[model samples]
Target: MTLPFPSLEDLVNVISSTVDYIVNIVYNTIRGALIDFYNWLMASIEWLLNYIRANLPFVISVVLTWTALYKSVTAENIPLTRRIMNILTAPLFSMFALSLVDALLPREIKLPRYSYPALAIASVYAETEARAEYIIRHRTGYVVEAEAETEARAIYSLGS
Candidate 1:
């Protein structure tokens, strides 16, 4: 008499085939996802490069303007007339500075255009931080002085 159920070998074969199928499915899914991600990353980089290339001149202009304005506003040693003159002729000064730098740098070694905007942004951040610190210091000093004055008044009142 033979058993009606499948043989052990047949059951093992079926299980192995199912596992292989599932593994292949998973592998294909992951590979497709990775390819999509890679494509998106490359597209984003290309767009960024194109945008920077297109806007480089505008970026340089903004950097030069910001630098000139910041320097003119912050120059304590200069007379008011000189500061006004500097502000009025900021464009010429900026051009001269750029020309000087271009003349000084080695022709073989070119600097990236992005560095100009980055440096300008850094300078603005630094100035903002300094101004914030100054305000905070003065505010705390005023608070301390007020507290001391209040304490002195309380002491005088008690003595009287």
Candidate 2:
């Protein structure tokens, strides 16, 4: 019988050379990709920083909220009871708004988990409008503004 054999040292050298070539190619590719990605990220960050710094109003808006718009009392004719009801319901409306936000916001994005304040100044007018609607629908003397004004003058004999 005839048998063929390969030298162990020659086999090892061939495998070693092939592995070294593969490792070099992979290392260079990964290193180049990493450097490019890092440079792109740094440039993007610098651009964004400069943009925000140049736009003072944009920067301020990022820090400010819409709460200032709803803090004033705009209704002069609504009954005190309705006004008080609006005030009391502001927190409930804010809760609904936060719930809506949670429901609508995409889950994959970080929502920056925050506790809703007991009430937001931003929802105050919305609460007032809802209360006004309820009052006008279920209660007398709280009808549409024009009708209420006519009725009020009829009773008080002011503009009759």
How does candidate 2 score on lDDT? 0.46
Model 2 RMSD vs true structure: 30.7
Q: State the lDDT of candidate 2 residue by residue for 24-139, as single tens digits.
A: 99997786566556656665665665554445443333233233224424667777787677766665565565555545544432111111112112223545552211111111
Off by over 4 Å in 1: 69-160
TM-score of each: 0.43, 0.34
**lDDT, candidate 1, 1-160, per-residue tens:** 8899999999999999999999998997786566556656655675676666555545665689788888988989999999888888887766765666555544432222110010111223545552111111111132111123334333332322
List the candidate 2 regions with Cα displacement exceeding 4 Å: 1-6, 57-160
lDDT of each: 0.55, 0.46
Backbone collisions counted per model: 0, 0
Span of ten consecutive residues with least summed lDDT in model 1? 113-122
